[model samples]
Target: MNTIDKRKLSRPNFNDPIPNMKSPSPLPDATIQQKAKTDAVDVLNARTMAILWKE
Candidate 1:
């Protein structure tokens, strides 16, 4: 049996990989996260208006 050299194996370079990340302007979270944020804002606004109405 002959010994095979391991140094001939090739690998892809990673230094210039294509970016898969999303833009930062509006963030990249899922719609569920966005809905949750909106719901929280609505709840807070409603509570604030209620308190203001009572004052």
Candidate 2:
């Protein structure tokens, strides 16, 4: 018969309370960001076209 050793068992320390730090919330919706990016691109294209037309 084989006997298990009690000295090899590991235990956690319960003397201190764990920190309650929480992660930040998720980012805003994807569609809103996409709209902003598209608007920026459109503005840049309009400016470029205006400059080319003036030259």
Candidate 3:
């Protein structure tokens, strides 16, 4: 089996305990995230408008 299949087979308990590394990482910056969300919303809204215009 592949690594993913092996993991699925023994999901509850694996060969080793889960790690607890607690190094904090900063979240994505607000402007970058806002741009991505805006792009996605624009794409969806354009598709919706196209469908409505067709109907």
Q: For each candidate, give its TM-score against the true structure.
A: 0.47, 0.48, 0.47
RMSD of each: 10.7, 12.7, 8.6
**lDDT measured at residue 52 in model 1 versus the true structure, 0 to 100:** 100
Instruction: Tell me how candidate 2 scores on lDDT.
Output: 0.68
Candidate 2 C-alpha lDDT tens digits along 1-55:
1233443344444665665433243655576678789999999999999999999
- Give lDDT per model, in order: 0.70, 0.68, 0.77
Native RMSD of candidate 2 (Å): 12.7
**True-vs-predicted CA distance for residue 21, candidate 1, Å:** 23
lDDT of 3 by residue, 1-55 (tens): 5999998877775566656533243655576678789999999999999999999
Which regions of candidate 2 deviate over 4 angstroms?
1-28
Maximum-TM-score candidate: 2
Q: Whose lDDT is higher: candidate 2's or candidate 3's?
A: 3
The local lDDT score (0 to 100) that residue 8 gets in candidate 1 is 30
Each model's total of backbone clashes: 0, 0, 0
- Per-residue lDDT tens digits for candidate 1, residues 1-55, read 1233343334444565656654455644776578888999999999999999999
List the lowest-lDDT window of 10 residues for candidate 1. Answer: 1-10
Rank all candidate structures by their lDDT, best first, as comma-separated numbers: 3, 1, 2
Question: Judged by lDDT, which candidate is best?
Answer: 3
